[model samples]
Target: MLTTRHFLFFLTGLCCFTISLRAEPAQFEPEAPAAEPGLAFLLPTDQFLRQELDEPDDSDPLLPPPLEDSFSQVEPTPNPDTESLPDLKTLLRPRFDISAEWEPEADGVEMISSDLNLKLPLYPVFGPPPPFLTAGYSFTRINAPVQLDLPRDLHQFSLGVSWMRPLNERWLVRTMLSGVFATDFYNTGSMAWQFRGGMFAIYRPNEEWDLAFGALATGQEDIPVLPVIGATWRPSSSVKVNLMLPNPRISYLISESETRQQWAYVGGGMSGGNWAYNLRDGSPERLNYREWRLVVGWESMPPRTPGRFQSPGASYLIEAGYVFGRKFEREHQAADIKIDNSLLLHSGIRF
Candidate 1:
């Protein structure tokens, strides 16, 4: 018997001999003629090539064929003319506006006096009256005095918020709310608050002209109801001049008493110009009492783009007024109490 290695070598040699004997050559077919080197091949079964050869090729301009004018006699359809549409932007308008201000002031005070007398003297000093003389002498005396010192270092602040809504391109409705806070004059460490609201009919007929007519209402502890008619003229964007007639209603109670008195006042104020930080004193007639106040202060609106009607980022206001004159009292039988003039100042934000 042969070894396993010799038998494996003999089987490999026999497989190689069998593979060489089975190898065969492929049969060749004849080649067709080549027309043009760059031309794409077309199948013999293509539909266009199967049609009749008599039809003329309209694609090749260099090859002219005999033609009758019958094809040219076909009429062409005409297209209707259409107009271009206008853009939406050209049919609409844009508007913008803004208003705001700040005010601050210092100095304020109040004083009071009272008379404790209730009865008249029995004896007539000048003349004899038939019915007046009471035999017994009973005299009633009246005398009382009170004084309040307001804080000497006083600060008051105010802020205003205004909105303007466009009515067409040149007109707007304007409204505003303003609030003020300051240290109480008599209480020293206490605070006082005042609020005011205004509404206006504003007209801007041209770029260089502005006019407004409005009414304002202001409220506080001493002067609870203040109604005013206001007008403003703006010759330029940064300049404004204003005039106002304010009717202030004042209410006060007698010292250590429950009796309250209410009175109305009509007054007027004038400011130099828009950017001017000066206000002339306002003088108004008192209805039930004689009272006077002198105010000098500055107010300014927030800076904003001319056409952007929006809330001001922040605003400040200041006012300093002095109260003088007299107040009558039934307790003070002989004379009225004099209110010494004092300073009031305030400053704050609009929000």
Candidate 2:
């Protein structure tokens, strides 16, 4: 019975195949025209249809595929114009620099002292100084033997202004007027006020060089005169050296700006002067004083989108120095004056 059933199934499949073979074949027609020489496979049917709908039949040939980037290939087309642009370097350079320093020190039981100093319009106080003006005060104390230290406390205050104009590119005409008030041994030092006038010239041959010569005439019960000449050289942005003649003073300044907006400066100089006094007889008293100063200071400015003449900045400075000088009375005086070398340090801030 099972063999008969298998034979019946096979006969049914053969009959269906015979009927399919007699049916006519359905035909396929090529949708696109024949391919042309040099042409590769045509774009997919959907993409070809979309391009035809968007562009007119007379459209220009589509751009060639970007040439393989070989040395002989023509340069690629630049991108279309856009608003975004690269930053310019000229806008990134810093335009101005500012700095300051201070120092103070303590001696033994004899004394404790402090000094405050500042510089402004810091780029060499350049241009014809138009109406230069300054005001400052100083205080000092002494703790020696009462007989030798009458009026051991001292105070000095001053106000000064000057009018300066450029005589030429390298020279200037400088005239100044100033007044001072102080308490000291000299009548001028004790006076309520004193006046002074001076004229000076400044010559700068180039950005790295400077020369200054000046004579100051001071008015008081006793006249004091000062004639000075000085020069400076800046070999690099971070280093400066200076020399003064006659009194023979030398100075150097070094500065650097590191990351984190940290900045530092080191400056030092040596200077000397002479003092003279005439005794009752023909004998004369002379004193020689010399000092060496050193200052190491740091500063910081607020984080800024770097630019020129931006405002609202502050700085701090610390400095120290040593001074050694001799105060000589007449040779016949009871005692030859002696002063120990002294050290000073100070700190200050500016905005």
Candidate 3:
């Protein structure tokens, strides 16, 4: 089963790899800089163990002291004995994020959504979850004219769990499960089971690139089954391309003297998930809602505080975007109805 993210990352990597293979490879810049933990704000929301997956909060990491060591040698120099390697579970830690998005009514329709995610590295109450476990909750609501449209409240709540583990030094696995609860009436034959699952084996060829392939699937009717093949690359300290995928961003680090560890990037990705709701004063058929998003945003950490890894993480963000290619599809309404493009305005905290 492929989630939206599975497809996003998959397509992103495939496109980038194809282009790179065709073009001559340039000398990589200085063994690719460590993925800065401060940029956790830039991660894709749909990823499992997000911050940890890319750059876990490691107080002390046992990585090769020199970049060349990772590529040239199977074992690093300082650690002649591989048995003494630090366990990744110790480097992993709990992480959480919360954010909300809203769009003004367009064509007499409006939508709002919010999400909260927590990665429980400390799940055993005494120790950590062997690999890693995460829990997420999402709430969405779409308001429309009751008189003109059916009295269907297109609201949904989703609870999901994600499990991740490093299969080996070069491969990591991520899987997810989500359940849907809707605020609409349905018959015994109707049920809204928005279950989605994905499995990806990701490989880090070097410090700057991550390659992965898998499959993403969903039980929802609107979203399609996606075969995953993706790539994540950072050509330089400030430029990153996720390929033909979601959450691609280009950032500029502001002067350090600015008090806040300030940085800004403009990014965008696919938004909206399938929702099932019954029609009123009509047939027993239901409808599915979906949309695509394009956003430009700026986010910065709280000033004069410990960084995201050390203390509770917090960031200020403001984003303006547009949602288009919106549609509603179902059996009775077999034909998808196009919704007008709407302006998206969002102000939220990521903590």
For each candidate in turn, give its C-alpha RMSD to the true structure in angstroms: 47.5, 37.9, 12.3
What value of lDDT does candidate 1 attain over all alpha carbons? 0.26
Error in Å for residue 276 of model 2 = 17
For residues 1-351, write the lDDT of model 1, one tens digit per residue.
224663354345434433443312111100101100100111110111111000111111111111111123454333221122222231111111111111111122222111110111112232111011101111111121323211223333444443333444445454546554433233222224445555555454544333445554543333343332333333432333433233221112112212212221222222110000111121111111234444444433333221111223332334455444434222113443344443332222221
TM-score: the better of candidates 1 and 2: 2
lDDT of 1 at 89: 32
**Candidate 3 per-residue lDDT over residues 200-284, each given as its tens digit:** 5556778677676676565556554555565667675455555425445555555344335566656665554554555665455
Candidate 1 TM-score, C-alpha based: 0.29
lDDT of all the models against the reference? 0.26, 0.35, 0.49
Assess candidate 2 and give its lDDT: 0.35
Cα lDDT tens digits, model 2, 1-351, are 124553454345434433433322111100111000000011111111111111111100112211111212455555432122212221121111111111122232133232222112211233212233344444444454534322344445555654545444455455656665654423332233556666656566665665667776654332256564666555654444544333222223333343224445444443322223233342444322234544454545332211112223443444455545423232234664555565544444333
- Candidate 2 stretches with Cα past 4 Å from truth are 1-109, 112-129, 184-193, 218-223, 245-312, 326-336
- Provide the lDDT at 124 for model 1: 23
What is the Cα-based TM-score of model 3?
0.66
TM-score per prediction, in order, is 0.29, 0.48, 0.66
In candidate 2, which residue pairs get closer than 3 Å at backbone N, Cα or C atoms, i.e. clash?
103-345, 103-346, 104-344, 104-345, 104-346, 105-345
